[model samples]
Target: MTSPSSPSSSSDAEIVVVDLFAGAGGLSTGIAQACEALGGTLGEDVRLVAINHSEDAIATHEQNHPWAEHYHAKIEELHPPDVVDPGAVTLLAGGPSCTHHSNARGGKPIREQERASAWHVLHWIQQLRPEQLLIENVPEFRSWSRVIDGEATNDGAIYQQWIQTLQALGYTIIRDDRGRYGVTLRACDYGDPTSRRRLFVIGSRTHKPTAPEPTHSADPEDDLREYRTAATIIDWSDRGESIWARSRPLAKNTMQRIAEGIRRHCDDRLAPYADVVETLGPEDVEQLQDDVVPIDDLETAVKERTEPFLVTGEVAIADGGVTGEEPDPGAVLVMGQHSGAYPRDAQGRPVPTVTTTGAIHHIAVDAFVKPRNLPQRGVHSNATYDPGAQPAHTITARNHDGHLVSPYLIVYNGQSDAADVDEPLPTVRTKARHALIEPDLFPWGLDIRYRLLEPHETKQAQGFPADYEICGDTKRSVRKQIGNAVPVNLARALGAHILSWNTPSLSTFGGGVTADPETEIPAYAEVSSTDD
Candidate 1:
């Protein structure tokens, strides 16, 4: 894949942006990067006036962008015309409440609630009236109709109405070859690394046939760079297998085994949402539903096995020494292997592009259970692990029934002879298990061996700064934030291209503007750094 170019060097070359419905500032963040690439600062001449209804999302936006003024109330509460610095505003962008347009747009008997959200995009644009405007929504919005009677005719003709209003306001409409609303841009084509296709409406004072020529391309051999992959920003330095700087020690043997499995069992190393079920204990199954495990409890288990115990005989304990026979074959062995990967930090390669499925979480080898006595159970710990060359499956958000579908890595014993078991094997264990498991045997110990991605990981992958705090503490809220925000890197890439295409004359404006900054003016917003 082509490496991303360096940020623009001139501070005075900034471009200003105003964001409406700016949930968690994904679009703003991406625009910031683009400004940087074009040799400009996001806050100086290039500003981002962001607005969002969710307090939690706005809070996150403020923490990252202390300079930008944020409105935490509904879009209806504020008068955008009063807040904008007209002359300096390069872009006016809004992705209004699209839930209705996306989920219930064409459904029969449209409710009144649905109509309001779908029609609000243009309402906000009229108020902010920047030099340019862009609207993003699901591909389905192209054919969306406001329902009237039980049947679906053109219904309210939402698409036609939007186009007309934009034109009436002297805005030009640009459509991609696909004929979707605005422009049909494949995010991956711009080297986002993820296949997130979005419908964008870009208009400027001067009518243009298209939005902009794509700076990045999907086909490596067709003039554009190769598309990026999840590995690009994974930060695998300390963690052998990650794209980032953390380390989770995998057994040398285990790594080799996993590699073999990937080659033999998987059709592709980066299988998206390929499901694998490790024979989990009743407790793990419970933890999956509950969404948490006692960290202290799991950590203690790893501590005990730091050094393989002499399980053939009794060992001394601080409380007292106890003697014992070989461990029973029936006793399950839980191994705590190292599963470290990824050191999250914004300074690393820019995060992967963001997506609607950004809320999806992955399963990881957070903790493992290794029985203190392995020989008695005829199990041997793997000694040679190689993470750098190995990769786990890709993770996606859509659920399969109730199961959070994602990739899995499971390991089972190769020995299942009658001699190993004193009693006949249970019938249930025989039929259900990973193929890696020996016939008639259940997977006794499953480490992350390999696992799916997590929402936090997804956030990192999607170009949010590593430290970009996803506001709400609840999983559902976190998912919403992640899912809603645009990928900062992708936005930045596109922003930089716009600046390159339109090298407008520059002016100074780094400090807060006056009560009424001119419609076509530039000013800086001064800032003081804090150690905190």
Candidate 2:
């Protein structure tokens, strides 16, 4: 935050930016990168003011964007005039809280309590009157509505009215009505390694705003750079708990999913097609050939297939329930949490958009080790997370829903792609990714080793720079910040696009009125919180 009153802050700075509902500096980082791309040193030439209601989020953002001024309060409480010079901010940007309009809420109508967060941006725009405004949200935000004048309006009335109000304030709304990504875009197109999509709305008071072009693509014919893959970003060295020696053991379905994931993903010649049945639900198994053998056949088959030595809850007797002190040698092959029906994803592909639930989604690994005495890493402080069942929102990193555990997983075991019940699939990232081990290459007694993706790997997948510090006392806190972030590469692309429209065409472009000598344009009504 550059104080206009401070002589050294921004008296001669090139740009001033304000981020409302700024979550962990995703947008700010990208904006700073955009500034650098445009040949400006961030600390000297640009000043960023970040505001958010979450104290932890504010701390995280401040730590990462150290040069920026941060406010740990809601946007509505801060008077724009007191925070920054009205005319100094060339760009005003932020994604309002999308909790109300997310598709996850289903068709529930937004109550009064849920509407004010998004509407607050209009007030800031009126007060700050920046040359440009950029807003981000989930696609369902367009369907928002409110009760106006004692009569319920259409489903999208609130958004329509908001847009009209923006137009009234002499701002040009930049939109893309056609194409694959009208206003919503996939982050992988901008070099993010995940397959997350977001909606962006850009407005300009002076120049015409355009969408950022894609930098990477899935199709080679497009001539764009290839998408960054999960394999490239993941730290292979950080495999978490070994399947062989977990303090607690894997769930029945989870072990089954790993068996299939290793069989299919590792390019093993004799893949685990029959092994998949061992992990499948009754529905899937019932559909299989009647000749398919039951668990009774697993032990004899294991001796021949060189496959995973699964120790599930129901099938523990197959492996004699394990060694008294540790897993029997030559027992475990690969282990992973069940994320989706696919179970395993190719390493050379971007992961799905990261989420705040660092807990519920278990980390996975596929490795085989010789039975030599290798020292084990101490259990992580955050390992207290219960692998038992919990609500979806609890693990989703909301302020107060979960068991306060850092990272956990909702292990979905079964043969079907969507074997789990009611959980949103972990974006596009595969569930149990590859950790190859050829049994023939190793002597008999071997260890099974594997781990989940570390916080840093998840952060990088979301496009945050490696050195950027996420401030929080706990792993859950750090995950909350990362999950809530906009992709940095996507943000940078948008920033560059907005910056390209730097020249303000001051002649009232929104409603075709002129600022200098044309017909007078009436001022937009200041919407009160009561109206929200």
Give the winner by TM-score: 2
Q: For candidate 2, lDDT tens digit of each residue in 1-532?
A: 3334322345677988888878878899898899889888776788788898877788888777887787778888777788877777878999887766665443455565666777899998998799888898877677667655533343765676677678788776665655211188777778776555677877777865568789887567999887665444445444343333344444444444443333432234224322443354434323332333233343453445432333222211112232222222123422221222112222221111111111121112222210000013211101111111110111112211111101111122111111111111122221221121212101112123434444565566667889888777887777777666787888899988887665434243333433312213232222234324
- RMSD in angstroms, all models? 19.0, 13.8
Residue 88 deviation, candidate 1, in Å? 5.2
Most accurate candidate by lDDT:
2
lDDT on C-alpha atoms for all candidate structures: 0.41, 0.50
Clashes of 1: 45
Model 2 stretches astray by more than 4 angstroms:
1-10, 105-112, 147-154, 179-182, 242-450, 502-532
lDDT of 1 by residue, 439-482 (tens): 10011112122222234544544457778887776655555665
Name the weakest run of 10 consecutive residues (lDDT summed) in model 2: 385-394
